[model samples]
Target: MNNKTTISSFFWQIIKPYKWWYLVMIPGPFVTAAFVFGYNYAIKLLLDVLTQDKILHYGDFVYPVGIFLGSHFMVDIFFRISNYAEWKSQPQVRKDIMCKVYDYVMGHSYNFFQNNLSGSIISKIKSINDGYYYLFESIKHNLTAKFLISLLCAICLLCINSKIFIMVGLFTVGLVIVSMTLYRKLGVMQGEISNDYHGVIGLIADNITNIANVSLFASKKAESQSIINHQENISTPLRNKWFKLNFITEIIVTMIYSLFGISVLLYSIYLKNSGQITIGDIAFTMSMTFLFQDNIFGLFIEVKKFVNTWSDFKTSFSIMQIPQEKIDKTDATELKVSGGEVIFENINFGYENNNKVFTNLNLKIKAGQKIGIVGSSGAGKSTLVALLLKHFKADNGNMIIDNQSIYDVTSDSLRSQISLIPQDIVLFHRSVGENIGYAKKEANQAEIENAAKMASIHDFIETLPEKYNTLVGERGVKLSGGQRQRIAIARAILKNAPILILDEATSALDSETEQQIQKSISDMLETNKATVIAIAHRLSTIKHLDRIVVMENGAIAEDGMFDELLAKENSKFKALWDRQVNGMVL
Candidate 1:
């Protein structure tokens, strides 16, 4: 949704929908500045009246006192209005940003997830939340109100006495120029720090995910040292560079504020001695100088914070700049599975760096066909499944389902018709029932139990303390490899999609369990009249299928019925069958 090229543009566009809330907030800063300046003006009048009694009207007492107190009341009233507006606007803006970021990030192709760390991506998302919070607050309070207050005081001094104005104005400009220049350099440094922090998080996440491996190898010390080395050699040095530059900026800023204050006081004494200005004017001038300095200090603090926030905001949210890898046609329609026939026509595809997996390949599966695909490593077996599922688009070809081009339909609709039970199944940390019910979001308990029964996992689940309600733990670590495989099978049966893909699905199960599950799956698909694609390294898994296709070197080397292919002399299927049979005997 973020077609905007610049971050500022994106920020403003997000805020634009709530423009009315912003309008109510904008006036608060201006009103606050006027009250502060008017309060100082009133104080001057009160001093003048008190010092020279009867020279000005004695009745001026009430007017000066009233103006001074009235300004305070205005300040209080305007603050409430601003606070209410902020309450309405801030959270909504953040909510919209988070939702937009999630939807857009999820649209990234399957490879995006495979290539990046889960923790690093999570950290960047959090950065957007904090960065925008700081940036927005700084703009409202410091950049707008405090800024107006500084300018008003400067002009007030110029109107009454030119000398004080020149001294304060020069110092203000010098500090601003120095700050802006330093911030540009500091912002880049902060971006580097952010990168280091993300890397550390990703490293920790990677280690945690491989905890089993580390414990098995007894390499905890090595892993700990690796993390320490990364933090000391990289993270610490970048942060230290930021701290040093911050100290230098602070030193320069202190010098300017100190010099400006000293000059103002010295000039005020000169004016009083020459009888050029009254005691009342001295009080007003000193008061204005102090107020102006405070506002400048406020401005400096905000700018420093803004620099750091900008660094985080841009670096983290830059993922928006990446165009989605897959998109549907503008007129894309929902996919309809009429008999579920799939045709791959003149398909050419490759992964990164022109690593060709398939070239001008073609295949066809009739409606409700039980097809078995067997191949060795890098023989385009899995790639074929990935392409058919539309996880990656073909380089030059059309994939049609039920006479409709997959490219011409929405991905969600296309994928809805297919159920995939991947080899390495990763389950959410939820109840056993919830994991199985994932296939159908609204599935009842009865349906889930039935699916589990079909997959032969229901009996095992019943022995657990909470039965189907038992927690799976992180990535289903609570369960054995065989148990996890059974859970995956249960989901596919529950989904009962028009098309089913089983990629080494029963590999973890024992010989008897695998055979039983395979029989159950064949019966289920045959009952539903669904098209099934089974890819397996185990030849026994596909021996019962109607037809077997043997793939080699990215092409179909042989295709026939199980026994028909074995009967052929020097057939590809016959050689594979003999090798597996011989290996089993050994």
Candidate 2:
């Protein structure tokens, strides 16, 4: 959408849900304007009463004083009520918008996340949240109240003298023109400033997340200098420019207000001295002019803030507007896994147009078959699993599980039937039990303990002071790589899906631990009659599988029983096995 459309829709989306609160708040600005107008009139009445030489009774003096006090009290009450209404509405509005934005971010496709920075997305979320309130405050309070007050002041001045009215009108026009011009300029600068700020945040987050790597590589000094350079060379300079512009705008606005106030005051005094108007008229004119001057200053500040916030709003909505790349079909159904049989037929897949990973590939596995896949780094090992799990849509293919096409099934259901133990295990900063139970959120402590035991990590967990309750730290940094891998295995065990995938699952474990876990996995598969697919670089990890498939450039180079492949000296599997055996001997 265009900027104008996006801005309008964003505002409406935030406020439309809580229509009642906004409806109540609609009159707040008008009431405030009325109070300002009434309070000035009250002052005029009081001045008139005090200046009158012929005070026949004390009631005249008391009446004007009482009116002034009463109006003051009423205005104060109205202000309080208006503030209370705003306080009640704003928190809920902010919370709802924040939640909605979070939901949108979470729903984004995997590719979207791969291309964006987590810290930058976080910055956008916060910016949108603050921007919404800023814009709302500007429109609901400053814009409405100031406009009404200015109009009332202009009318009052016209009644007193057309010359005064004409002067105020021209000043208003000039103020608006200047404010608009400044607002546009500031918005462009603010957008640049915001981008630089996001970059700084992103850099900090990236450095912190990889702090271990930096420390291991002894690059802390370099990283720190990089951050400092970003701050000094980009963020700091842009911020200075933004603030300077704002300061200049404020100075100009204040000067205009001062000039307007001076002109009105002189005109009012001249008219009073000529006996063309009373002291009351002079008092009223000066009071209104001073009030408007304050309002105009506040209005300009709000306008500037609104402009800056508009930039933030646009940045946030740009992310939200990204269409989901993977969406379920209208007639998608929940996948039913009867035998866990999987087949890939006539598959053509690629990351880019010129780089096809798999072209016209075909593969099939029978129910409860333990198949091992071995391939080079980019030979489509992980990509094969990803396609079966529907992480990415195939360029042209049919991936069928139990005679049901995966594309015709809901992604959640299609994935629920399969459990993957990824090579690079990433654990949340949570307790051991919590991480284990992630596969099944409703799993009880007993189930968690059982899964851990099966994965052969139960003994290690018992050694820690907090045991199952210990915090894993960010990405499971508190634990060893082997421990993290075991935790992931425990999670997959708890999942207990019909189809299981082991992508270098034992890569981090020591030889003894690997053997124990492999035995446990083998037993589990036998007991459950599960279909298994293991992708590994180490031939030892998959040498005992029921069937072995060696891939070369995304095509099946060799497919046979492990013994048969080993017997063939010319086979790719035999070549990989020879390399590993020779390396170990050396």
Candidate 3:
């Protein structure tokens, strides 16, 4: 992005209505400067009056001392109040920015989520929050303070001698130009280094999640070496950038200080020799010159920080600009799902590769019927369900529910009427009750218990020390494979959608548990009046299903009743059944 656009967008994104704190902070510099100027003037007066005529002048000393002390006290008070306001505004701004970012990410389509890592998204949001807070604090507190001090120094310098004032101002401006030129170069390096760091985080998260597989393959040492390599890659560039900026800033500041100090000393000597100014005037001028130099130094540091923050602000704003899926219009009609009839007419789609997974594939599922789908890996079973949920738009198709095109209805309304349990069951680190309640958030304890009973898991839950309150640990790792599958089933049961889909749902359970769970499910379907779609690998699991459809290479391989298919030799269904039966030693 160009500098102007990046800066404008960054400010618009991070600065919100609460930025009134910045306006409140504007006058702090003037107030502080006024007090400092008053104190300095009093010092000049005290020095001139006390030394002149060697007189007692008790009143003169007393009045000037009070003015100086009182002005110093007021400066301190203004500093404290301004600092308080600046810090107070930080947390609110952080919260507002984080909330907006959260909304943006959550609103994105599932495809966006598939392309990004959860840990990276979380890290980006956190990094942006900290960056914004620092940026605001630096501008509202430190920026204003330094700018005010610089102005005070400029006024003091002019009051002392206009020649020295203009010269110092010119030199300071030169130093700033040089520093900023160098800062811009380092800013690019910093941005690159930050991107590399994010890559490291993504890598570590991926590795840690797959640590079991890594250990199984004996690649632990190789993984550690890879991480070390990435760490060094990120650190080396950052160190080089920082060291270069540090070295350059130090040189410029030193040069400016040296030149200014020499000029002040020589000017004071020349004026004193020519009898143009008194020793007291020279002394006060020198003190004020040093004071102004200190302020100028502070200003330089603030400028460097401003440059770095500008870079980070640009990066964070760009991330927020990535396109997200558009939500349906506010007035879109709600889709009414009943009897679970699904009709697909002339459907066509592919994942960015343009190789269609389904092309003009028409199918109809009647209400109250159990449809069994069997397919090899990559046969588009999961893809079909994902499209049914409208996770992405079909290249061209009409997916109708209750005879209405799903696209015409609100997405949430369509999804709410269908319960899907995928092959991989992901359980949150929460209580069993809490996890199950995700399907029906308002469900009371009795409703939760009822759902568990329907899924054949209520007995197992009651055996735990805390029953429904038992913590499942991360991804429900504390539970056995069969137990976790049952909990997922309970969640789906609680949803109680008119249409239910179980994608390889029984793949993890033993035969006894599977049979019992299936029996419970059949009974519950009858009791609740729900339709079911089961995707299975064992083939035998669907012998009781109403209709079985076999898929091969993204197309239907065969479709027939279990008994009729068993009577035909070399048929896809019979071959699958024979393989499964022979594999079971019993």
Candidate 4:
């Protein structure tokens, strides 16, 4: 997460912090393999003592018994020592990885979140953490210990008989070649499955998020069938590729083991007939063969797990490759808000694949001035606010605040000077006080209470069981539209920035409450000489504003005071005002 690492190198980059612990862990596997050899030798010694033609001595029994108990005790001690470091490091590393990945996701542009599913992003982050768990386990139980066991067992066999060791070595090579080839294919298949898995998570999230709509439309069965279809699509490939390949690999491994067992037994018996090795040597070889074979089986299972983990990790890591949409210029400076005079010069903008919404559009609002913008839907009202907030850069134009081009200033600094009350206000699932205080983190209770009073929501809030401490629920679902809008207003009022923009700020309130809020907003603005740009669909909400600008399509059609615009026959504002007065549908 800290370094610029490729997917393949990220594991080691994270592991580097705990290098000393891993170094200490290396000897644990060696001791485990050594224990296997020691225990096999004990078995051989015990068999030799029991089968001896001459009377067995008590000393021989003592030697075998001591070897068995000592090997077990030694391995247990070595395991506990190595495992302590491993347990200390792996879980912490996973927690760090999840936190870093989540932080990286947070830094992504707004468009990225809109384009991707939240659930899918969460799933990917989980995969990265789980993959690390698999990697550490594989290193411990699969690769190091198993390889050492195989090597040590081969050496033991070599000491017993060169011919048997040669056969075991060749079998090891063949089995590895076969496993590697199949594992490579499995890796590719697993990558495909990982993608499908992410998609399913996203689809399920989408369905659940819109559960209200599904219930309203009474499409329960339809939605269930949709999920079933997706499951079927995923399961077919999973069964065909994932399950089938694993079964084939298992079958091949089983066949190889059977053949090796038969060959070793026949060779050992022929050697016994020729008096080349004792019964104890044969016992040692057979016992070692079973031990080594079990480890190989475990190794293959872990290797498959590792391959799937690597595939998931690669899929999840690809997210970091997406370039962040908004990046501050290296030479950008902070925005110093001496006065909040805003100017839009020769602006050109349009949504992708849509006709131009603004061409050479221009507007200017002086400091300490309050102006209302009135327009029908698709009249570039919200787009103007978006450009002001730097949500989307215009195709061509310069937006200047206090004579500083917004692009020349750092985005964070630029936005800090302007407070916007958006049309669709989404509140966090938290206490109302926390949501209001979000605009100003250091704001105390007195300041938060004052802002809520100014927004005209304090009285209603007092009626709740928890008052300001009441949970808002997800996206403020527990609140009415009017309540949510007032919450947004409170947040903006608390911000108290030099520049303020309100888009449909009072649309959800009733006419009486709207007028009260209009007065409250005016009183609040009068104390602070800040610039205000208000966009309104309900024209009366902004009728008391100092000036009105009427928009048609992508350009301004009329500009004047509210009464002045109404007096003119050709004015767009007058037409809109007339329509509203007549209670006409807009």
Q: Which candidate tops TM-score?
A: 2
TM-score of 3: 0.91
Cα deviation of 315 in candidate 2 (Å)?
Answer: 1.6
Which residues of candidate 3, in runs, are more than 4 Å off? 1-16, 19-21, 76-89, 327-331, 510-513
TM-score, candidate number 1: 0.94
RMSD (CA, Å), candidate 3 to true, equals 3.0
Question: Best candidate per lDDT, number?
Answer: 1
10 residues in a row with least lDDT, candidate 4: 1-10
CA-lDDT, candidates in order: 0.86, 0.83, 0.77, 0.84
Error of 3 at 226 (Å): 1.0
Task: For candidate 3, give the lDDT.
Answer: 0.77
Superior by lDDT: candidate 1 or candidate 3: 1
Please give the RMSD of candidate 2 to the true structure: 2.3
Query: Cα lDDT for residue 177, model 3?
Result: 82
Candidate 1 — worst ten consecutive residues by lDDT sum? 1-10
Predicted candidate 4 versus true structure: per-residue lDDT over 15-91, tens digit per residue: 78888888878889998898888888998999888887897778879988898899899899988988898888877
- What does candidate 4 score in Cα RMSD to the true structure? 2.8
Q: How well is each residue in 1-586 modelled by candidate 3, as lDDT tens digits?
A: 2223444565566566646776666667777767766777777778888778866757878877888988888777877876777677766767777887788778888888889876677767777777777876776657767777677777777877787788778877887787778777767766666666666777788777777689999999999998887677766768687777778777877887778778877877897798877766776777777777776777777777776766665665556778677645557789887778888788888889787788787777888778888877788777778888889888887888888888888888888888887767879999999999889989999999998988888998999999999999888878887777777778888898988887877777778877776776676667665667788887877778788888776677787777887788988878778777899811
- Candidate 4 TM-score to native: 0.91
Q: Looking at candidate 2, what is the lDDT of residue 210?
A: 89
